[model samples]
Target: MGEENMTKTTTKALMAAAAFSVAAPALAETELNFWSWRQEDIAGYEAIIAEFEKTHPDIHIVYTPHEAKAYNTILTTALAGGSGPDIIHTRAYGSLENISSAGYLEPLDGQVDLSLLSKDELLGTTLRSDGKVYAVPFASQTVVVYYNKDIFDAQGITPPETFEEFKAVAAHLKDAGITPLANGTADGWTIEVMSGAFMPNFYGSDFFGQVTSGATDFEDPRYVTALGKMAELAEFMPVGFEGVDYATMKALFTSGAAAMFVGGSWEINGFRDAGLNFDMMPGPSAEAGGERMVATWMDGGYAVNAASPNKEAALEFIRFTATTPFAQMLTDQLNNIPAVDGAVSSDPMLQKVASFHSAATPYIMLVAFRFNKPTGSTLLQTGLQELMTGAKDAATVAKDISDGIKNAE
Candidate 1:
């Protein structure tokens, strides 16, 4: 009896060991690290990751959100140091070009099936000059003049149709003890938005394309005139705007302290949450009878690191994002215009912004045009700041920008 029992127990132990060995490999998890700079997007992405993990139990996503201003430098340093996240949140145009040129990004062209996305979505500013795709498009944005509807109604002011009327509206708002505009120069990027929005209206739609083709320079009279108009608007902005940061500017506009906010469509959700009645329109044309032009471009999207070890897993995550569920979540939850084709957004403001697409032009500085070696977006920012502070005039700032580019060459 003792020998029989011992033999049976040994056989059971061997069978259990073999079963455990067979299952261990299948249970092992593959983790993909995702990096992004949208702190506001953490909750949305977390939800998506949770849903993704439900379907793919063997895969995990580790999301790291960095501060917006320092994200590029941090990402570049990490990529250059030969260690970085598996998936990178890259900006369109110049930033993407810089990273792609360094061979840090994996081409999504053949690796990922982007057939579900529209051509407009796939071939945005993320497309390289060689016609290769470096990143999957996520969202698109257009710069528009967001006006406080309550203030406008109370002041009996309708939307302005011309440059003079725009200035008059600002002056009337200022006289009514309201800050006519909210602008933050401390961060420097918003100035680019201002320039991108106005420069096109003054110089015409083909202006940036011409600049990209070497047919025009930054010192063009139209550019200078745009700066002069911006300087005029600055007079109606909050006192000490030079020290205002982005948060302050947003707060000022959302809190009803300012009558108008000149920014991108990305801010629509935040404004809607503030419960303020607002409407957006393309900024007034610099010409008395000319049409307004909205400055638009692809915001950016996720890209795979060329050196990532978990390339297939990263591609799976990207593919997951392209699915209808995740694409709709991006539109509904984040209020972003999703890159996926027929991804309808329930956001009314975004729809309203999109309605102006017929009159839109590319956001030149950020989207189409590139800077020469020494000068780039930062130079343009500084020049605009100088113009605002009276440290330089329109012509001088324009010349400085042109010289910065030319001298760099």
Candidate 2:
């Protein structure tokens, strides 16, 4: 009575197991889409993604990077279309605020563990208007001067110790037929980069406090001095310097035709990739042995799209970023300061650039006034271009900035 019935039950059990296996194919691995503005760092990010995949075999990240300048439009269009990447690389401060206010980002405060980040890093991603955090900070950058080490050694000159000596060094380089500063105004942003050093050097630390507090504005005598110092160096730049764009200016220095370039720490990887021997300095002080300062800002962060279908997977990746291994890998590959703790680039130049934070000031236009009407940054950039030409004086530039930022609060 039992033998035939047992065989029939076993056959049915085998057929049921086969059917279950077929249905299980629906549970494929989760894939997270990551969008960024760092089109150049694609390889670096790929290495990062590969490392993360080594542990979480159940999840995969597909990285898609857009041109930095066009990213805003691209992201806005995607979000407006009711579709976007699962993870977004967001700009800090006002830019972050713009999208967060529109509710495009997942509020990250309690969702993502961010104990690895410093207060400043969190503050950079905080939407001021709402007082809530939205992303995990990735990097912070300083605006400092990059000088060709070979050029400096060839001319037997060290970095200047004071403002006057700074000018003297420029004169010396000029006499040696080396373009002293590769910076120029054809790119409006480079002028702002130069100000990162000039503003703190010429105006002193208190100036930011005074200007921010409404006790004074950019029209102060100190700001005029900063603009004047920028103008005074025109003779030491490349011929027809006002027409030199950022790429050409970078070429002048990287090619050894110019001695120095004032730019953001973001330039470190590019200069290194160019095979140039270079180092950075916080521009000189007002007096020998006095303090020096450079402008700095949080570069931005990794965020989860509010409507992401794979939030758990996206957040696991963010959690990996907060780990020391991931932070060090990011630092080593990107050659930029990681916003997380326990990872500093052993690359000496990046280390040196990070050292500027000891005397760093918030990048004035970006950190403070970018949200303002007309934008103090826009006013300063345009004003500096005019100051470099003969169209406007330092005082006039100073007045223009003061007027533009009067409502910048």
Candidate 3:
């Protein structure tokens, strides 16, 4: 009860409280590493991360963006070496399957709540054979033919509804001294997007599944016909078309040098900023009465690494992606179709793109079909290039693709 004893006890208690306060911050802080191939998406993702950090002050996100061409190889190397990022941006379908089969991905089944997303947003293509989810689908994209409205209006050409009409339009544009289609085969992957836009019209939705299941192969008469059609279309492109790269192709279309660009919905913002009046249409059907189909699929999204040192923090970030704010930011800023349900954008081009979903089919070779190590896309690209150069016939190109698939297996 003495005054000196009471003063000493109070000072000791205050010192202990100060020590605990200093240690509390250290215990609460957590950092998560996120890896993605989209450098263009950095601003949108950073905005989302900043918002996420507001509610989760203890968590810090280290965003690392890689070049698209080198991302897969680099990510595979890192994962195989057992030192990959905590969060990974993964492509859907075969790419997901390839990584999941290697046991590099954490199954999101019970760890993350995706119920906020609709069934369509769950991306059935990313589901494993056992029905477990390995990733959260973030966006959906469709391969479309983006035509310059000014160019079309100048020539009085309406968008074609049938393959015959498409051919006629191309001829008309060519006769007008305008390049009909802007494509860059030099990048190799552009052929996949180009083929995705056209091949489904010839073979239908079931064709890709049949090829994967061995019910039909690439050497079929239909595939040869598709190759022939591609070659015929190529004739409308500029001379030495293979020399054109992606930038060149985009320039040709946006600068009004070319009448149309064959690409995905992701290019809308770039085209809009280029001051070109443009619109999109679903890929035309092969026959006059054939179905009009658009090549649509779930694009890449985020997944957790099974070997991550910060698994819980990674899961928390992934769960946050399903929230309304994140989805809205994706739509408003990136102009992408968010994978979350009820996430709508006021962008007119996006609205027009979504209008074609009723006629959409899974992107044939990209999502529905499982490509082996070398990929059917690569083979088809090389074959089409050879055909363009007159070094290979449609039948021979088809046979080479069939044999490549078989050999890869």
Candidate 4:
């Protein structure tokens, strides 16, 4: 052969070798079908998976993001039918009540390294029972008061620090021709915030701890007092709040139509993205200058499917997700504050919210976590709605909630 022909043949051989080297791992990689409730910024998730893939060259990820509203129902149906993702993200309450009882989740106590997380950092009570952590907590969210800076400044109302001051502020806002609170009571969960989140403030820590433990009945004096306060405050809220939905109420605050909104930290991104400047202050105190034990709850975490055919691969996938940078990516890029300590936040709004969460003492509230008895979410919603609509008195509402717990238990 000519000298040029031999050189070309050697170059072709090198190219072929490189191609096979890349294809070999690509063909060898084990695949995991990972599913989530929403597309919810898959780019962030993908970044984590990419990093995991680099480490485990023999593993691959199949990402499937589902519709947020239908994910739970669909996941349950699929699990029953024997076909689902290798790993799934689900709500804490749903996981404990629905998935755990169904035997769909593998107990993760010894499987994942729980010692890396702090007891105070995780949603302390929500993620653990019997001294074993079933789920790896991913995020802790608390209900807080988001207020329009312009409105508060214009009305000369410093954010209310006490229940009495809260009432006066609301009245002042009303007199100033602005709705005091941008509450959307039409949704059931909003009612839950008032009953489950806000009411505990009125009852104080000890009373709430008793009710949560099922030691004191839900109809205790503190419970009634909280309901009465919610009823009284409802009158000062916007007149058309009954017709509002979550998005609408969020818009009301964002657009400056309403003075304040009380909700969880999940909406921080939306508020930030709207480019509307606002300040998140403590919720109006239930007592005069008393410490507010914010109602913070565990959002969700990684759990291996008990019946997954690819159990080892599923576990590898979860281990990678839990321990690796991808786990941090879930919070960092996606704007969630992960249960992992030192999970940094780039968004100033998230940092602000985290500051509030860090400032809260007594750590997790028992009522928020539904600790011992697991407060009936449906019953709590109904009771609060009745109070807001003037359909039930404070004492009657408390009794109904108490009875609802008994029936469930």
Candidate 5:
């Protein structure tokens, strides 16, 4: 062939090589499945997953979120079957026991540096019997009274310091044709939340330590007094509150028809999204000049399934979740108190909520008493519901809890 014809053939060969390169099958990437019950946070998890994949081109993560109510059953069933996702979004405290104790979770202790968390923070993920940590603590939830600033300003009310004053404030709100407290006994868990959020202020700060240490039981006079204080709140709740559900109760507050709501920090994002002007406070002290305390708990965490095929990749992702950047991302995206101590959020409401943490106590039933069957949490919820409905008085309810689960640990 002539020199010009040879040059043309070489160019054709080069173009063909480039096209083949573009069309060739891509290298197989390790696929990791991360399962959680946060179905609403798919976008937030997607952002985190994208960031992880950016530096880890060889690993791909799929976030699978189940319905929150059904998640525990689904996860336990899958794990028991000797098959589950690579990364599991496990609940904290006693909720982690069944999975970890059953050998379904990969013990995360030395594999992931949970050193960023303090010993107290790590308690949420540590197995009680073995002392083996199974997951990275993800977030901390604080329970407080959320008040609508717009209504409070209009009603000329400041946060009431004493239980009597709080009741008076509620009465004032009611007289103005507004629902003073947006709560109902219809939802069992919300009742437990209210009891957690407000009872410490009534029982005094020392009761939690005493009850949890075996020095006292739920039937102690102090606890009965606290339950009595919680029952007093029934009179201040929205009219016909007995029939209202959690969603309707929240709507009553968000729509400005109610003045205050006793709820958790997890409600922050939803309140903000509704454009409601609000602030939160630890509940009123039992008496004037008494110390006020808030209730807090470790929400949940991420763990690796012991049977996962992509264990290394799952560990990489779990380690990433333990980092400050990921914590910050989670805080910014979800407005949560990310469990990492190094992670900080500039959100004004979160900052205020954090301020309340200075005097916070562990959410009583969950942190101290959820490890066994007929958990204190179950008893508290049922007792509180009965107390709220007048079907049981404070003393009876307290005795019921003490009889049911005080010695569970």
Candidate 6:
């Protein structure tokens, strides 16, 4: 061949090589976005994602953590704009209902193997709604009574079992010049549990169910009794509780300024890691001298965005989170329970927290998911806060909660 012809052939070969490289399967990588509430959650998630990426080299994930306060609002705005992450964590039953109803979350029942997972691993009520599952159970944190063992021993007081004993202890502590209970009433949700969980024990487990189902009136005697008990408890709590928040309240407990505190199991790890000497027991029951059982609520779970472009990948992520090292990490490292079955804690404090849940008899109260709407609990929270401040009487607070539910309907 001539010199010019040879040069043209070399150029053509170089162009074909570049085209082949561009068209290769190695270049076809799938990317998905995930949004979550906790910044700390990202580190664990990233560790999982790193393993996942190694297994599936073609998939790349982008994870973003949002501050808890900004989480739902940001997700709402993104969903409205038709742009958001492929996966997100949401509140348990009621929240799942709202997001699913709004067409923002995909039904995850058939996509994941629910039967293989243990019923105990999940918040049981969350797994089904009318016999159909909507989201994958992720992390669960249950509320429990946190007591300073040193204080209880020093005061010669045992942790309260029944409501009457609880009152006696509070009185004893008060007389001893120690606040029997240290709580942060500034958080509206804290106050709601006092009225919604602690007091409702007098009415039985089905009390809230009846109210939610509209079978009972809001002005019923049961609700009034519960509200009254809440006010009574408030009178015995430490002063300046209204100005406190969870962090401050936790600090007080860790610093040994308070004898007893009520919070979720999530705080156990923090307290343990802080080297605080504390013991946990169930909250007081309504029946005098009855078994030490109390109302409880679910904390966290994973849900897939209905509008996600990478639905399959998101479902896989949910499955992973509900299983193995990720599941164990939630309980082991973060001091939270896994939504999967057979999850146990190696940490002694977490082990106690789990034992309390296992020993719960008759029923584990569903205090949080009282309404289907997202704002239902908030309304309850607001009413409880007003009641605590004496701005609203117990009857009016009860009426307001009932009225708010009616309006939500």
Which predicted model would earn the best TM-score? 5
lDDT: which candidate is best? 5
Model 6 poorest 10 in a row by lDDT? 16-25
Candidates in order have lDDT scores of 0.79, 0.82, 0.80, 0.68, 0.84, 0.66
lDDT tens readout by residue for model 2, 372-402: 5677778998998898887999999999888
Report residue 43 deviation for candidate 5 (angstroms). 2.7
Q: Model 6: per-residue lDDT, tens digit, 9-65?
A: 455444432332232134346787878786655666777677656655776888888
Greater TM-score among 1 and 3 belongs to 1
Ranking by TM-score: 5, 2, 1, 3, 4, 6
Q: Could you give me the TM-score of model 3 versus the true structure?
A: 0.87
Q: Please report how far candidate 6 places residue 167 from its true position, in Å.
A: 2.5
Per-residue lDDT of model 3, residues 1-409, tens digit only:
5999667545544443333233112225788889998887788788878877766778899899998889999999999999989999898778888888788999888876565556665654355567778888888998899899989998999999888899999999999999999986787878778877887788776776787688999988888887888877878776688898888999999999999899999898888878989999888898877887888888877899999988887887777665555667789988888886546689888998888887887776666445475677778878888887778998999999888878875
Q: Candidate 3: where is the Cα deviation over 4 Å?
A: 1-27, 117-130
Question: In candidate 2, which residue ranges exceed 4 Å CA deviation?
Answer: 1-28, 407-409
Could you give candidate 1's per-residue lDDT for residues 70-139 as a string of tens digits?
9989999999999999988888877788888888988877766565566767655354667788888888
Worst 10 residues of 1 by lDDT: 16-25
| Candidate 6 regions with alpha-carbon error over 4 angstroms | 1-31, 39-54, 57-63, 117-132, 195-197, 322-326, 358-374
Error of 5 at 166 (Å): 1.1
Q: Specify the poorest-scoring 10-residue window by lDDT in model 2.
A: 18-27
In candidate 3, position 210 carries an lDDT of 80
lDDT of 4 by residue, 210-325 (tens): 65577888788877888888888787767866777777887788899888888877777678778877888766667776766666666777777788876666666565444425
